[model samples]
Every structure is written in C-alpha cells, then in structure tokens.
Target chain A: MKSLFFPVLLAALLAGCSGTPSKVASIEDRSVTATETKFVADKPLVETMGKPPDATSTSSSLPLPAAGRSGVAVETRGLVAPSTDVMGLAEAKAAEAAAKAADTGATAKSGGVQDAAILPYSGGMNQADMKDPASLLSKRRVQFDYDSAAIRDEFHAMLEAHAKYMKTNSSARAILQGNTDERGSREYNLALGQRRAESVFKALNLLGVPEGQMEAVSMGEEKPLSEGHDEAAWQQNRRTEILYQGE
Target chain B: MTIEIVGGATNRIPIAILPFLVAPELASGTSDPALVVAGDLGRSGYFKLLDTSTVSGLPADPESLPLAPWKALGADAVVVGQIKPQGSERVEVRFWLFDPVRQTRLSALSYTTTRAGLRGVAHRISDAVHQALLGEPGAYGGRIAYIVKHHGHYELQVADADSQNAVTVTSSPEPLISPAWSPDGRRLAYVSFEDKKPVVYVQNLADGYRRAVAKFRGSNSAPAWSPDGRRLAVALSKDETSQIYSLDLLTGDATRLTQGGALDTEPEFSPDGLWLYFTSDRGGSPQIYRESLSTGKVNRVTFEGNYNVSPALSPDGRTLAFIHRRDSQFHVAVMDLNNHQLQVLTDSTQDESPSFAGNGRVLLYATMVQGRGVLATVSIDGKIRQRLSQGGDLREPAWGR
Candidate 1:
C-alpha cells in the first residue's frame, strides 16, 4: 500500500510540472518561450490597434545594411526569434514589406512634386504630342453652357488629368482660348469669353498648376466652329480650346 | 445700280429734275450731275421726282426756263443745272430752282470745283432744292463716315450723304469700327485693331494723319467727341470691367464717370454739352442712360426694352436714336424726348450703330444681309427705307452734323 501511494503522488506531480513552464528551465529556453508566447498574444493586439508596436524599432536595430539601404520600411512589427532562421525571415519579411510599400508608394507619388523628377523628356513633354487627337493631352477643350463660365462635373476628371500633366512638366506653357456663340453684342461676347477662359484658368490653378504657365484670352464670336444659327452649333461654338506652346 | 425706294412715298411733294447739261466739249467725259440730284431727292422719301424723259428739250438759261413742259409733267418745282469746265482739273456749276406752278425763279447758285467735286456740287444743289421746297435744312451735302470690310481688309471711308465719292481714309488688314466725326467734320475718331487689340485713333480727314488717342493696357473703344471737341467720351477697360471715362483730348487725362461691375460703353454727348449719353447694364440688362456732366448725376433714359445701346441724340436734342432689341431682333429706334413715344424706324433684324443725320430726318445704321453687313437708312418717321450695299461688308456708319 505504501509503494502504490508514492507512485500516484509522483504521477500527479509530473502532470502539474508539465502543465506550466518550470522556473528551473535554462534561461535561453525560458526567455525564447516567453517571447514567443508574447508574440502570439500581441499579434491580435497590434492588429486591433491598427498600428505597428514600434514603428522604428525592428529595422533600426538590425545589422543588415542591405535592409537600411532598401528604404522599404516594414509597417508590420516583426516577431524577434532567438533562432538561426531569424536573419532569413527578417530579409524575406522586409522584401515583402518593400513590395507593399512600393505598390502604395506608386499611387501617392503620382501628381506629387517628387513626380517632377521622373517625367519624360527632361521633366517636360513634347509639345507636338499635345495636338495629337489620340493623345490624352489633346482632350483639353472644356465646354460650357450658354452665358455660363462654371465648369461642369463631367470635365473635372479631364481637367484633373491635365493639371497632373502640367504639374509634372514645369517648363511647359499653355494658352486657353475662350469662344462664344454668335448671339450677343461683339463686345459683350468678348467679355463673356474672357470669363469662361478665366474660369478654366482658376480651376487649373486650384489643382496645383501655376498661373505663369497659362494665359487666358477671349476670341469672342469672331471665330466660330460652326456657323449654323442653331442650338447644336452654338453648343459646339461655345468652348475653350487649350493650346500648348510651339505646337 | 439705281437707288430703289423701299417705302414712304404717300403724299410726297412733287418735284421735277431735268437732265443737267454739260459743255458740248466735255459732255461725253463728264458724269451726269442730274443722276445724283435725282437720287438725293428720291432718298428723302418726301419728294416725287418726275421723269425728265417726258419733257421736251430743256432750257440752258434760267431766263428761258421751260415752265410749260415741267408743269405739263405734274411738277410743283423744277431743278435745272449747267456744268462748264473751268480748267483741266476744275468745273463750274450753275444751278437754278424754279417754282413751275407759281412761274417764278426761286434761287440760283454757282460753285467752282475740281472734277471730283462734281458730286458735291450736285449734292449742294439738291440741298438747296430741298430747303426751298420743304422749308427745312437737308443733309444731302453732308458726309458720312463708315467702315467697309472687303476680304478681311477694313477701310475707313468717307462718302457724300448720298453714297457718292467714297474715299478711303485709312485701310487696315484688321478691324476698324465706331467712326465718330469731329464737330467740324474735319477729323474722325475710330477704334482700330491694328495691334491685335482695340485702340482708338483720331485721324485728320484732309491729310490722313492719325494719332492714337487711347492705347491703354487692355481695350480702348467707343470714342465720342464732346460738343466742344476738347474732350472725348471713351469706354475703357483698363480698370477690369468696362467703364465710361471722359478723356481730355489735349491733356491725356481720363476721369472715371461710372463705378460699377456692369459694362458701360458707347458714350455720346448730348448736343448741348450738358449730358453724356451711354449704354449701361447696371439695371440688369443693357439700357440707355445719361450722366450729367456738371452734376455727375446719372439717370436712366430707356425703359422700353431689355437691350438698348449705341445712343445718338439728334442735333436739335429733340430725338434720341438707339439700337433696341425686340423679340431677339435688334432694330434702330428713335424716341421723341417731348412726347416720350418710341418709334422703331427700321424693319430689318440685326440693325445696329444707329446715327442721326444733321437734319435729324434720316437715321443711318448697319444691317445684315445673308451674313454680310450693309448700310441702311430710314426716315425718322419710318416712311422711307433704303439699303446701300455695294456687294461689300459695311458697318458702324456715322453721319457728320
């Protein structure tokens, strides 16, 4: 009876010891396990926080010069492991982060001041291309309602694209020629045409295009695209044409 | 082409104009003076010019006037003239007006002029005949300043009121508009677009010497001479929007006369030199308005239409002529200042730049004919209408007082 009682007591003690880490384990194993466990627990916390635990921590302390030079900052907080595979995992993580950073970075860099650096033709574009009907730059004419200079919503995107192109090419210059239908007095039509040109000019200005790069002029009713005395012709006549320099 | 009367011939006074005789030596080379006289009288719409073909041989001397033939042709009055060559470059004209019914010699006048002045001489005779019969002054001898556009070339032309002897004052490849005559009719102030922008110039009619009177940064147009000819009422856009400004023709000083956002232009001074009549859109749409020169007080003069522009007060200050827009058509209208009754004198659409003749009986303006502009005139009473188109574009006609 004494021998059976001692074996049961030993089995109960071993089960209890295995259920929790023992304080008598080696420091390395304990520390690594503690850290690994913390990581598992903190991952959901980091995700819920929607932020890296330490934005500048992991990459800054690494001995990898290749990582620093890459400029591909990893937004996710990487887990630190006291194992031989950490270097390879960190590099691989960094590369993955870089790819993501590049994808997002591409979106923001477009139309940005930094974009001026990589534009075609020495940060400028061939002016002749602006006149090509198939080119996006050729879609510069902005139409308006009768006696109105207000820009329509449909033209917003086209103007934005133009604004972006103009922003990227600082050396380019453009002329906005405003026209009108043959209905009002010649002098009044001239003033109205000017208002239309100026309206486009102001929109471009708001989109980051410089004022010096563009000039507004009114051709009045003198130059009509269609001579028919009808609404359809008038609509076609009342438009502002964008012309680039030396094109 | 002959002058075809458009309207206004009922109850017209009867007058007979005989064929003017030239010296036998120069008859074949000289232009007939009777044609001009007949045209001038017929255009008035107040005279019934008799057919001279029905009459027998005309008398050369006023003493031997053939009253029986003229009276037999239902003539109330008769005009006979003789043209004699004064020299190689000049001619002497002797004209006589007769009252055939009363059988009396009314007046006789003689003028010595160059061959080119034959038209002027005929017009002067026509004026005399008009005054004698109608007991009122006539603008037959006066000059009309206008712009003629041919193949993209603009010519500032001056012609006899009867549309004869048209002389190009200055020809430009650019547009020239709004010709205003000096009080003396010796110079013309006009807007020229030589520099790709509107600029006002005053040119001497005799020598064609021109000087830019207003060349401000933006636009300088609608130049009107004051009564005294010392100042010009100009519409300038140097201060953002168009505004009326009195520019001293001698001192180069411009005084702002209006302060608003609406366009103020086409300034014309009242004949009395008291008010500056102009067109302003301050009342929401363009209307005729007058500003007192002394008090600087502004008053609205036109309330009949939403669009009235190009105001020109008659020499007597009794009538106001302007372009009135009605039902999308612009017509020349005249308002009697005393009765406040407005009468549209033109029946054509797109009539603009109405100007009054010195007699205030005829109003000359520009009208469109199948996309081309032509000069047209109407009697203030809307009785007589005539279009003077020589197959060329014409615009902005101003008759000298």
Candidate 2:
C-alpha cells in the first residue's frame, strides 16, 4: 500500500498539472493497433484544439518505417494537443516510438516514399491560382439539375479529384457555396442549396476526407451567375462553387 | 419605372376628388391631400377617378357646392375636404363624401393629425369613401414589409399601402429574406444571414429592438407568424434535414410538427389557425401541404402542378396563393379553396414570393423585370396588374394589418 501511494500521488499530480495528460502518455506506451481505439476515444480532445498543423514537419524528421507507424501517432498528438508541455512531451515520445518501430518493423522499408506522396502540393498554388484556368483545381464547380442535388456522372471525375486532394492534404479547407435557380420560395431554395452542398460533402467524406475541412453554405438564388430567365440560364445558376480558404 | 394604373377599368365606379382647401393659418406646406386620395383610389382598381382639374368652381363645403357639375363630369361620388389649423403643429381635416346621383351627402369624417400625417389622414378618408360605396374592406392605411437587395446590402423596408413613406427597418451586409409581418403590424419576423448561417429574428417596428428567435445548429430560417402572434412556424435543419417546427414565442420552446427525411419548409398559418401550410418534397417533388393542428393529419394542398411552393392564404381563408410551375415557367397562381379552381395570376417566368393584402382582393409578389427583382400586384380576379420598380431589386414582400 505504501509503494502504491507514491506512484498514485505522482499520477494525480501529473493529471492535475495538465488536463488529460495520462490519456496521451498511455498511447505512447501501447502498440499501434492497440492505441487506435484509444486514439478514437481521444479524437474529441484533438478536434477541440482546432485544425492541426500540416504533417510536413513530422514526416521530414522521422525515417520511412517509423514515420509510417508514427504518422498515425503524430496525427493523434500534434493535431490533438497544442503547445502545452504535455503535448510537446507526447509528440516527442510518439516520434521516438515511431523511430524504434521503423527500425524493427518490416513494413518500414517503403515508408519514406509513402510519406513524400502524402505531402500537399506546395508549389505556387494559392487562392488566386485556384481560379486560373490552367490549374486542375479550376474545375471546382458541380452543377445540378432543377430542384435536384445529385451529382451527374460527368462531374464524378472532378469531384473525385477534389476528394482525393482534400484527403491527402488535411490542413487545407474549402467552402462549398450551393445555389439554386429563381423558381421556388427563397426559404425552400436555401434548403435545396444546403442539400446540394451536403451531397458534395458526403461524397468527400465517402472518399475518407474529414468533414472539418469542408463547410457547406447555401447562397440560394440570391447570387445568380446567369441573369437570364430561360432554361439555359437556369441550368448555369443551379450550381455549387468550391472556394478554398483565402481564395 | 413605377407603374401607375387608375380608373381605366370598364366596370370601375367613377369618383371625383376635389382639391382640399387649406385654411390660411396651416396652408404653408404644399400638401395635396386630394391628390393622395385620388392615387389611393386609383390603385385599388375599383374606382374610375374623374379628372379634377377640368372642373371649375369647386367648393370645399359640401352644403354650398352644387352636384350638377360633378354629375356632368360623370362622377358617381365626389369627395371634398377642408384642412383647418388644430394647434401650432396639428391640423384638422373634415371631409364629406357626396353622392352625385342622389345629390346627398353619403358620409363625413373629421380627422385631427400632425402635418406629417396628412397622407395618413387622406388614406383614411379614402378608405371611408371606398367602404361607403364598394361595401368592401379597404387597404389604404395598411403597411407592407419587403426586403430590397441594393449595392450589395440587404435592407428590410416597411412602406405604406400606396408605396409611400418607405422606412428602412434594418440593413445588413448579408442577405435578409422572408419578411413576415405580425398580425398587429407592430413586429416583423425575418431570416438574416448575418452570422453566415440562416437565423430567424423578430424585430419590434416601434423601437427596432430585435432578438434572435431561432439559432439552432445547421439553419433556422423561414419564420411565419401564427394568427395569434404568440407562436412562429419556422424551418430548421438542426435534425440533419430541413423540417417544419413551431416555436412558442412566450415559452421559447420549439415543437416539431412534421417528421420525414425529405425537406419541409415555407410554413404559413390558416386564417382560423386550424391548419399549418408548408412546402415539402415528401411526395418526391416540392408541393404545398397542410397539417391539421388538432388531428395531426397531413393533406397535400396542390395537386395540379408538379411543383408548387410558398403557400400564402388569403385574408378570408378562401384562396391559397403560391408559386406554381407550368411548362418550366414559374408564375404566381391562386386556388380557390371552396371550388378548387386554380387560376394563374402572373405572366412572368420567374415570379416568386406571393403575399396577400389585408383585404383578400389583391396580392403582392416578386418578379423579374429586365433582370432585376421588382414588386408587382394583381387583383385576385387575374386582372388589374401593376409593377413597382423604383427600388432596386426588391423581393419578399409581406402585406399586413
């Protein structure tokens, strides 16, 4: 009982000094598969920290095998925790474990190339560049039929490209501005616009992209791209424009 | 351009309005009360106003004037008034409605008001004259609340029935839509996108004190005032999909009315408060539906068109005005509840947001004129149309009280 009392007191002191410190420290001492469940439980804490920084710095320091395993750990620590002492300690410990796992695990052989593949396109692509016709991201609009939000087969390639980019680049954020034609009530059109945006959001989520990276907003029929009252203009007005942050 | 149509209908009753004579003490300002009355009567589309400038020797006193001249001018009725100084800043207007055919005084009204309220008094006199002759309720003194999008700003404006005295109630950089007036005409419930999300706000017109009534997650929009004004029927997406919900203004508690995975919105209350009308896609396409308050049984209201939305019932609860799509063109249509007779009311291809007047005689709606949103009104008989385009791109008009 005397031996347990000192360790228990030390643990309580550690928890008191930092909120949810034990929750992070326990993940560092566990295996990758075992820690996944714990990571899931601690996701809310990570999300509460807001958007995590780009994983670019984390992957650069650690070698292939360790970074592969530690990639998951780095997400849980760096994104979950902030600049607190406990977060720094957890991030360092996870890096060390990832390095050790890379040295022992056989799958660590191709980890370096995989980490490079996950890095976002950092070359001259900014908000203005997104509007450039030459840029692949310029084709960001998803048009819908009258009173319908279902993405046609023609837009699958464009939507899939966006989904792939968002999945690989977690730090990037985009806003989907849904619009409708001037036919129905303004309030009903607002809901229809939301449904269109949510349809795109669902598509991105199905591709493994997180919902935090995308915000769905409906502009309804207030902002119309085409002022014509004919069917041709209505078709153009019924669309969703994908605008990235700072764009 | 502001469209003005007066007294040209073949069946209209011819009326004459004499220039109101002002006493020397209060005759400083050039306030034409008789002209205002003529304009009001002309807009009603029920009266044929005789040209008053053509008549000679018009007397302000009804007892002193001879009705032979007005009868020669083809006027069934002639209205004459005198404005006298009531106080330092107030004026008293006494008007007499004379039946030219009978050569007898029909009615008389004595109104005391400030100089600023001269138009208001004139409108009241017009209402009295209309009631005495037409045997119908007049909307001369009522008000209308509408939203105007100008210079990238959304402004909520309240104006008198004749499009005079327009007061900007509120202005915001974001979009403001769905302006619904309370039954008493003292409050307006509307949806604002100020927070980058749709939220319903109830504002007191007297003091401009506004409070957000619906700010739940997802969206809180399309606020419709109940007949009693104690509750608001709103559309909320808090449950992951848009659904109709009733919020008690007194208790601040919201009760869900419709349960479905489809979108339900644009709620309006029946005149008797027995049913709540709303737009829903539960039948695979958007259409108007109403649910009985006591029985909780829902019934589809519009079956003729493939798409019908934004249902606004008439004041007498005999007609339902909504946006109906015919051959890909959206137009305002009214269906008589008693006979189930649906009549298309507008020729515009993009007519939306239909609102009924205080009297069930006319309706105000939004339509596109030269690619700009403008306000238009039509009598329920599908005749007598007028377009008001002075304001820039105005929409979502609600006539009340």
Candidate 3:
C-alpha cells in the first residue's frame, strides 16, 4: 500500500478529473493504458519536419501506433484526460510564443543553447547546413506552440537551414500537409490545418525555395497517430506531415 | 458612396432604384440582372421592389443611350454605370445612383475586382441602395449552419448561403451528429455515441463543457428546447416505437406529449408557445404537423414535398421552411402557413436542416460539395445566394434561438 500510494495519487493528479496537485499526480502515474482515452489525430510532430500537417485523422483515435513502431512515447502529462466524452484541442500558441521569448532572454542572460534547452533528451539540428532533411524535420516539431499552426521562433533557424537545402535540391518536390486535433468543427479545423501547412510553406518560400517546388493542403481531423482515448494519444495526433516525394 | 434620402413619414415620398449598369467586362460572369439585383435586396428584407418592365426608365450612358420616353415612367430615380476591362481576370466598374424626383445623382462609385468577384460587387451596390432607401444594413454577407452525414457520422457546419464553408463540427468513428443550438447563442445540443449508445448532450460554446441531458435506458434523442428555456422535449424509443416526451429540467418530471407507433420527432414551439410543430410519418409520407398546446389538436401543414425531414418556422410567424426533394436532390423550401404555398429557396442540391436566422429573413441548410458536407444559406425570397468555405463533412447546423 505504501509503495503504490504515491503512484496512485500522481495518476489522479495528471488526469485531474479532480483539480488538485496530488490528484493530477495520481493520474500521471496510473496504468499507462486505462487512463481516459483521448482520440489521437493522424499527423504528429515528427511528420511536420518534412511536410505540411494534416489534421483530419488525429482526432479519430487516441494514441494510435505510428508506422513501423517508432519509439515515440506520446506525453499526455497535463493536457487531457480519458473519462470526458467530448474533446477539444490546445490553444497553445501563446505559451509557445512565451517559451521562445524566454529562450531568447535566457540566451542573453545565461549564454548558449545548453542553458536554453528545456527538453533534456532533445536538442534540435540548429547548426545543420541547408538541404539536410534529417535535421530539418527534427526542428519543426519540438519547438512549436499548442494549437498554433505557425512554425516557432526556435524553428525559424532550423527552417532557414531546411529551406536553403530545398532551394539547392531542385529535384525535391514537397507536399506540405497541415493538420489539427479534434477540438474544433471540421471546416474550421481544415482551414486551421491549411494555415499550419501554409505557415510551413511560407518558411520554405522565405528560404528562396520557389513556390512551384512546394504545395500545401489541409486534412482536418481525418486520421490518427495513436489509438487511445486519453491525452497521451491526442498529443501524438496534433501534427503536420511533410510528404517527401523524393527524386 | 453614401446617399441620404430623408423625408417625413406621413407624405411617404416615392423612390425608385435606377438599374445599375456594369461595364461589359464586369458583366461577363453574371447570369441574370435579377441575380445581382435581388441578391442584395432580398437578403436585407427591406425592399419594396417595383415592376418597371413596362417603364422606359434608363440611366445616363458612359456609352450610347437612346433618349426620349424617360418622363412617362414613374421612376423617381436612375443610375448609370461605366466599365473598363483591367485584364483577362480583372475588371474596373463604375456606377452612379440618381434620384429622378430630385433630378440629382444620389451616388457615384467606382471599384475594381477580379472577374470572379463581380457577384460581390453587385451585392455592394445592393448594400448602397439599402443604406440609401431604408437606412438599414444588407444581408449579402452573413452565412448559415447546417448538417450532413457521411459513413453514418453526422456533422454540423457553418457556411455561406451558396453552400460554401463546408466545415465539420464533430466527426466520430462512432457518429457525433444532430446539432441544435441553445436560444442564447452560447451553447449547442447534439447527439453523440461516445457511450456506444445514442444520447444527447448540451455543450457550452465558451468552454466546451459537455454533459449528457437525455440518457434514458433504451434510446433518448431528438431534443428540442422551449423558447422560454425551461422544458426539453425529446423523442425516446421504447418497446419498438418512438414517442415524444418533455422533460422539466427543474423537476426531473417527464411528460409524454406524443404517443403511438409513428415517429414523432423534431418538435419546435411557435414564438407564442401556444403551438408545437413537428415532423411525423403518421400521415404516411413525412410532413410538418402542428399540435395546439391549448387544444392538443394536430393538423398536417405540407402536402407537396414527398420527403421533408427538418422544418424551421420563419421568424415572422408566417412561413414554415423545410427540405423538399425534387429530381433526386433535396432543396430548402418555404411554405406560406396560411395559403399552403411552397416556394423553394435553394435549388439543384441536397439541402437539409433548415434554420431561420435571427431576423427570419433567410434560411440555413446543409448540402454536399464534391461528396463533402457543407452549410449553406438562402434568402426566403429565393433571390440572394452566397457560398462559404470547405472543410470536411458537416451535418445538422441549428442556429441559436
């Protein structure tokens, strides 16, 4: 009983059916699968790296598996719970904006990317030369705002590098698909998804990549990345997929 | 350009709308003179359109005009417009509205637009005319909400009157459809299958707080709230038949308003709360039937539309709007309650879930576009038209009371 008390309390805390620190903490620690199921959208942050995001499939299922079992753990942490029947998406643009400002402020105060990096396990391709697809895809997903279709300030450096690469690679024809979660009406969601795709498209265009090289489309709430009915799954669904039609 | 024609109410000065001229370049995309004229006028609900077909009332030419016989027509106003082709896809149009009574030009305006935007330009003219005559706003810009079903899932959407803005409100693998709004414009009640069973939920618009309102054991759906915001009338199927029942929110008491094996759903209260109008197949084909609150007398209102599911009353208490199928497509149509006259507001499409805008000037219904569901609105007069954007498939958009 003593061993499990802390974990149970933590799971309830994260789930927050009751709004308390201990309760949310209990929700956080409970059985990885049985928490309230959040329908996951089709696109994820990883897909945003190379293409625009499609929002349709994400809200369909919760925390569904990605293709080929990519070791991506959907972190629901404090976002959503399972017991709630209807769902929505994050209005996370404001927080992402604040985070970027803090990053800049931290850079001015404490020095380099070492102090500015929040995720201990993730450091994006900030110094990759233009045209490297691997580094480009890594930067767009990690540093974006919630419910924001716009690529982030932290992402601009990465996007510039990616844009330069795409401009140089004349054979590359890219399709930027935008997406969103199941929080809004499908029409607004699709438009929002398109906006996200367009944002990424604009970033690539700024890199001097010709508009002809890239196209943007929106698929609002049609697919899903994870198949659980909890927050962990929904987080995995809110993303854009960049289809790299390679030469 | 703004025009002010103010006069005392007693004398009631007669006014006329000069036929607006479009440069030949701008007129290419337009089909009929009436489409541009009526799209602006009827949507506003402020026009007293006169038939000037016999009158030789004409505007001054930016081009050739045959003079004479202008005095015989009783028109007290005239307008002349000029056109210049800007490019293959663009046109520059100039128009002037004049008061023939005062013998002075009321408005002169010039604008440029894409060839595709000519309809919008004409609507702009209508807006100017409305501001000049009645001092009220025009309805060429507002949109509507409706419903559509795809793969058994229902979705609510917002769109222009012309069937654009095809957004999906909620799409579920298990079907989240049948959207209706609260009278206050802040909440929506919809049917969902989250429990893997049918139930209706009331969702707050500001916060998305959803809670089940009717979750009876067997089947509880088709919820319609009264105008006073007190009772919720719902249809629950029990023992192989669906019947209408009213639930008192405060008392938790359920009152059965309808009985029998025939489906009695889609109950909407008249503005006065004296009558309840609903759709029933009790008379064989689906049609609107009204039941009096005082007498409990039921009377069938429609005899035309073979398939009419959703019915919305006009805000004026004069018309009943519903979907009528003709030639394989369902179009939104309005019937005069007294004369039993049917006039189709939308044509050549599958339109359903008719809801009156707040003023009762127009109707909103859902249709399909390229197999995707969309919301569209049409004026009650069947004149003005506009289409919104496209999303996924939307279904059953009910405007708030």
Judged by DockQ, which candidate is best?
2
Q: Number of clashes in model 1?
A: 0
**Where does candidate 1 chain A have its weakest 10-residue lDDT segment?**
A110-119
In candidate 2, the residue pairs with backbone N, CA or C atoms under 3 Å apart (3 or more residues apart, or in different chains) clash, namely A46-A80, A64-A112, A65-A108, A66-A102
Which 10-residue window of candidate 2 chain B scores lowest in summed lDDT?
B1-10
Candidate 2: give the TM-score of chain A: 0.48
Distance from true location, Cα of A186 in model 1, Å:
3.1
DockQ of each: 0.00, 0.05, 0.01
Q: All models: lDDT?
A: 0.69, 0.72, 0.51
DockQ of 1: 0.00
By descending lDDT, how would the candidates be arranged? 2, 1, 3
Q: What lDDT does candidate 1 reach at residue A138? A: 73
Q: Candidate 3 chain A: worst 10 consecutive residues by lDDT?
A: A106-115
How closely does chain A match the true chain A in each prediction, as TM-score? 0.48, 0.48, 0.41
TM-score of each: 0.73, 0.75, 0.44
Judge candidate 1 at residue B356 and give its lDDT: 90
True-vs-predicted CA distance for residue B102, candidate 1, Å: 1.1
For B121-162, candidate 2 gives per-residue lDDT tens digits of: 787788888889989777787777787676666677666677
| CAPRI docking class of candidate 2 | incorrect
